[model samples]
Target: MPKPAPGLPTREQILDFIATSSTPAGKREIAKAFGLTAQQKIILKAMLKDMADEGLIDSAPGRAFHKMGGVPKVTVLRIVDADDGGNVWAVPENWHAETPAPRLRVRERKRGALGVGDRILARTEEAGNGWIAHPMKALARGEELILGVLRQEGSKLWLQGVEKKERREFQVSDAGEGKPGDLVLAEKAGRPPRITARVTEVLGDPFAPRSFSLIAIHKLGIPTVFSPETIEGAEKIAKTPLGEGFGENGREDLRHVPIVAIDPADARDHDDAVWATSDDDPKNDGGWKAIVAIADVSFYVRPGSDLDREARRRGNSVYFPDRVVPMLPEILSADVCSLKQGADRAALVCHMQIGKSGELKSWRFTRAVVRIAANIAYEDAQAAIDGQIDHPLTDTALKPLWACWRALYKAREKRSPLDLDLPERRVVLDEKGRIMSVAPRERLDAHKLIEDYMIAANVAAAKALEAKKAPVMYRVHEEPSREKLVALKDYLKTFGVEFALGQVVRPATFNHILDKVGEVDFRQQVMEQVLRTQTQAYYAPANHGHFGLALGSYAHFTSPIRRYADLIVHRALVSAYKLGPGGLTEGEAAGMERIGEGISALERRAMEAERDTIDRYVAAFLAERVGQVVETRITGVTNFGFFATVEGIGGDGLMPVRDIGGEYFRFDEAARKLVGEHSGTEYASGQRLPLRLAEANPVSGALRFEMVDGKGAAPERDVKPARVIKRRGRPANIRHQGRKR
Candidate 1:
């Protein structure tokens, strides 16, 4: 039904216009609706043409014709002071994060905006210009725009989080106001279909640890549904045991075994203990059986309890430098559920027989009612092995312990060469959170005793789960990237050693290289490099095998008090033994499956936080020794300078190219070298250099070092310089490796 407009009403008399009507209107009639002058009509046509190029509008053939419906069809009369104004968003419609949920990326347009290896700088979405996931585009299964800053490095996002509640109010337009924390669904008023949303949850103060954690949690969308109340509630429901906590009912008593705890000296929340004794002679093919009794935490922390809910939420405990943010309360983690010394706590035991060759013969998993006979520290255990400490570890206990460790020692040679000696540093902190020192953490035989038994238990559990067809989470590590190996190979060549740069680099080959340098003073630095070239692995139901351990199956079945993974493993094992370890419908185990994802994310968070804390301490320690000359190994090389870390120091410091006295240096990413543009003087990864600590800052906890005596220096590169081509790389020549004699 057409309202008699043109036939009855003159163009000048028309009050308002209706879009897409049954009756067609000419340009003049539509222009009349806007009360547009002849000159203004020409301007509108020009504006339409410009908008069309951006996919915002469908343009007519010539300036003489008027078209509609190509753009979003927003109508506004030119009553306000309108000029050549556009929308506020800077990102193009096609920009996207090329990685997973936590990865955020952006195109940089200015210097110092970001560079490779720099921390991602977090920013807000100015009014309607924020970057978040575009759900519609996601529904369309294409691209998404995230709020992130791009860096000059690998395909990874430096996740910097912004909290909504902390946002201040903004005047998006002179006529409009929006609060900082308010969630806004913004669309482009200027260009093609542009829309973004802002959430109202303020992340917290930027410098706060909570802020860092917030960026990670919200960015990854790790479920934090369980609250403090839930934690309190879990405590209430955990009074009764979940599995073997059913007491001496359906399990064997192994409390009399010479079970001993071997953990970090300061560790309070113990998890698993070890014992290797002669197996039931009638059943064993040969040799002894290793018994691993992990704390029966699943027995006490029942499913659906408040504690369980909160534990499920945190997924795991985060360890900081000075303290640990536990998954459970101190009452639970440090006492009741903890595998405390000499305490008669219930446990879930895995019994496996070891053959003459140290290979597993047969294994059985059960909820055993037992207690830890010894709560000894690793140092004490180490002393006992060395026959040094005469007090804590008695001669009577030493014999059995020594025998077990000796047996495991032989097993290493018998088994595949899986023991990869990685350098680990212990960060020291002062009273004011400043770095005191960085000391190498000692790895001992006692530590291995515990490790060997745990590894055996992991194998047993994996096999049991597979045998029963149980749906359980396995900690699987994946293979390294081929591209990373090429980069590493190029970097290694600066030091002058021949290595495989083709195909993929094997862990065993890398391990062999590290072993060859074991007598070298710079071995730790090389080991540190190896750590960077590796990838972190995590939990999945399907078996991918652990790359580092060279194991076909692996799982974390210890430290339930601290790690949620351990608890999940315990729960699975308990259910399996009772009902048989097997796959169940995902529908029936939705809660637990969700728990797996959340905990896996938290585990990463905890690891990152721990590393961050150590970095802080290392920085603090370096600050104290500023202006002091220290010998350092070039653990890494970049366009900026060589990254050198001294032995006995845990923190990393930078040596700017300017500090090198002789030649102009440039970063060659392809070659992983710092080459002199003029002199051709070079330095590569793993080279020993004498660096004088120049400057250190406490707030950022970063240290800077300068070369003391090396010649062949080139003029310093500009603050922000262009990239350069790299030469072929080789293994480094050891200038300071200890002689075999």
Candidate 2:
């Protein structure tokens, strides 16, 4: 290399110097070695800063300028794509700021060795002006626990993986005395077609009732049992009653307020309560002041303690249909911290004043001590409000809550949020845990009232923390992607409903499309498709403005006993406003970004686990009803198969392509339809048909259905979308809507 003895070195010269240097280079040393003047040093400084900003060099370690990461000679990568011609491409696992990270082609021998979503550590070299990689080792899948079924094939044992995306089977030498059809846990060794495993445990037989949830719980690695240390810590705290930590220093006595908690009929742990009264001051005539009090979990679960550590690890509580894996021990979530009637409990309170026009005028937060006046279920409260039942407490206690709900409802109407009405199913169980029946849950005004109250409180908490300029984890939802809109528009075109594409659209645009759904017969199908096009909401440190609720800022602030995110928000408010003990610490503030990401990941994991558990339960319920005719709707279609969701039961099943008919099907990806080649028969979404339950496998949570009366193959025809007939009155068949508490 040419010796750097110039006034100002070029970019190429700088790169070459650093590449050849054995020692780390600093600006002062670089300037001295290059013989640069004072003005030239400034130019070099600017160039280095620009380079560092572009990720060409590291600037974190003060003046020691080091080359940033690039494609390493030996690095780990994930196989992202494989072509029909047997060419496999991968990108670096730990790459820097490069968008669409540089791809490397694998050697021909290793091209088809790994499947999609597999990771590999490889040795790479620059070749043919591109890059070539040779796999040195295959990285193991991240999941520590392997869930599968023990299969006996002619006296040889194998473990069939449970995951839908994974296909490889493991050979088991030691079966742990597990029989065929039993769910098993195996320790996998080696890779690909030659992988081996040893059965460590034999879960129950898959066909047994209620065994589905147990299998899913272990398969997903959800922690169900608490450790002895954690239990001891909980018991020690539980020994103290609710009033042991309360004092007048920073706590407000709200015992005089007649607050009541509204929850589900079978709810065991109540974490929130509401009380509202007419604003007495003339400045707020015809208005109301609503107070929402949440259980003060932080007061007992302090930072760096055993309880706090375990709660943080679990992130939040997970509830299956049959049981719950609580974030805190039952002693806290169900007893001390639960907002039970007539019980004095610690609370974090949000007080909001609304105007006659239903707009919020002001709001504040406080640490409080409260006594709940009564406990009411949603159904009973609605009945009381409607005057259908002559309840003694209706005029005395429930009237004020209904009044406040009226004003809040007005404000919600003015807000015009994205409202997609999709009723959920609740499965009832008998004493022995067998599914008795499944029905759609009723959406009562009382439920909406409590939801409005919680939403207002959550928003106020976010606003209060933001006004104080404190670090906060916001509940955010972004606008849907353009690609999703394009596909949604195509689907909408099938119904002769036009979607204004390639423009800046608002939530109201979706509301408009949904409004037109009543003009068609497939209301449920259209709503499901519309919901799939929207973005999922999540937690983050930066504010992204929730699209679904149409709120500029929002956060989870209720139910601290169940959700850790709410607890974190409470701590941030306490620290920001100088509330006593259990405030957010400096260490937590500095790591809030990482904390948000960790808790968001935990939230997704909990959602997936719950969904899987429910799927298993539904499949087990349907296993007994095989060969019975059921109403089904086509939810998705592809060349390989079509997925249908059963009516009333809400269980989804697959009807394979061969079973649809003995004909080749052409898949139209954009239109999301499958067309038969021989008969020109079409299978599309939003189509309702009758089917018989062919099989229900609880082990894999798989439900299979076969079309009845040869109705699987239907000829395509141009038919007008029919308008739905509006119902006259509320039907007597009211179902209890199972909600995620």
Candidate 3:
């Protein structure tokens, strides 16, 4: 038996060692520092375990120890929030404690200013008042945190991902006091097969309706709660009244114009309104004069203000089935800035002269105070124009808008934009938060009328900025790359369609291709490929023409209440037209490139979160119909499996390759198809097949399908089996074999 050391450290001494250790202090390190014998080391291990049970010290990976409710001495920190005084605060990038993470005031060093969404390696210290962090060095932004549900299998705990595309489960290293079946926010710590994570937060039941969006909000790090300072600023701005005066204080009164706001019935905020009339001038006969009044958000949320900072961070409002996370506070987004009917509101108006051919002849911008004549829903406006409903505002508003749209449609047809029939699915929910129905929203002429007018206004804004030689944040969608177009051409050739690579591509080129394949079985498949071949749109200071709209100049000038990019354009117009206060500052113009990039990234973040929430809602709606057969169409094909979505109820499900039949299938990369080795059975994308709803996991939003006709097997052949091809460092099933022509 080994003898105990002469002196053993007290519990307080051990706690101090852990709290102040520069590196992860494990049991061996502690033993060496104390010069303890073998028996004394055993005693020290017992003490550490007792401390963990008592909730005094946390046992981290590699047997490291730290105080409960405390971060490591040197660890990664993410900037989360900032004060009105420019003091930034951060939290541990991978916090795993029961209590809320303690905010650390970052001490600005020579390293430079740290803004929100920045990551840094900092040395943390527990000060007398609170925690403080000093920058050691800056670090690149880390991977996004994972949101999942904790599940226990025997002695092991696992985190099941909530995203539809996440198929593998993560092994949990620390549960952070979370239990099985609890929704959690975790961070990845290790790689696959033995993938590990540490739980950072314990959210409630995953099956709840509100939890679906909440999961997405947290997963994407979306800012849901507004700062008190920002909210107060919005309220203060909302209280300022618009004085009654025409052409005074740089504001024009256009209250006499019968302007109308048309939007969705469920829309909470109305930001734009339109009015138009026939031109009486003989020289401009058959022309129309129009006004587009958008909410002047820049007037309220000015540069360098708390409200402006918050709006810029949010970029745009995120709309979900249950709620909307607005860019501005509700006091401004839904009440003050919103163009409510019979209410006087501040607006930035665009005046345009359109000729008979719908060509914009001239345009100007001005600040104005206008009263919205009426706020009509799209369905009601369409019904009124169809003579199905006798409405008072139909002749005053609906008919004139439709007449203007008729002329605009002529120009739109001449432009020939890349038109794709992509139907959007809408989820309807009851007051109790239960889903009522999920269906495709019907397209209407009323929607198109508003869209065309908005497009004209946006073009005018961009062109006006260019005339002033001012910086413009152009909405850019460049043409597809040669690689994608080549792949697309190969895919089309399978159907015997011709595509010339040497020709200069235009939106009309894609339109012609679709027209050639009109209403065929593979038209939807071809459309999907065309969409995949298009480039993603983004905002940039340098102008790159919008390929999708076929517009040489385009900027977002509508819906300033929801979009920050529109707000920036409004400020630019105010600056260029000398429309008085809230004009773009010199500093803002200088930083336009950086601002554009940041807002573009934020926009993508909002889109991803919104799409993910919708997927979760769809999965929840279909959870009750498991085991029933559903009509599905193959949306994509891969080496491992094929993905299909329900005909109407939209949620993609995977049909594994192994479950299809008892035969080896070879994947054709160029053709996007899979063929059985012996039976020669072929399955390709865009094909319709009946599949059974095998599995639907609402928590993960994952679905699995099976063939309704039962597993297919190849007939026995009295011949030698096909030669198996083996490749080093490749899976046996995924190895490609030469095919006989």
lDDT of 1: 0.55
Give the whole-model CA lDDT for all candidates, comma-separated. Answer: 0.55, 0.77, 0.83
lDDT of 1 by residue, 182-294 (tens): 22222112222222222223333333332333333344444444467765764664464444234336556787777777788778688887777655586565577677888
Models ranked on TM-score: 2, 3, 1
The numbered model that scores best in TM-score is 2
- Which whole-number lDDT from 0 to 100 does residue 360 have in model 3? 89
Cα lDDT tens digits for candidate 2, 1-741: 355575688777786666555445678767876888899998998798667645576531224555564355566877766766777788876543324467898774643577555778887765656778889888985444578888889979888887655667777877887888778887655444345777878886766666666766787677777788888888897665544544556488899998899998878789899988888898667699999999988788877888988898888888777677889998888888899999888898999997776677889988888999888999999999898887767876689888888888898888788888887767677878777876788899989989999999989999999999998879888777665787789888877778987667677788888887665556677788889888777777778788888899999999788788888898999889876778898887887766776677677778878878777777777888888888898888754568998887777888866567655565655466767667877778877888888887666667888878664433354323212222345211111123334
How far residue 82's Cα lies from its native spot in candidate 3, in Å, is 32
Candidate 3, residues 62-83, lDDT tens digits: the string is 4577787777777789986666
Q: Is candidate 2 or candidate 3 better by lDDT?
A: 3
Evaluate model 3: give its TM-score.
Answer: 0.78
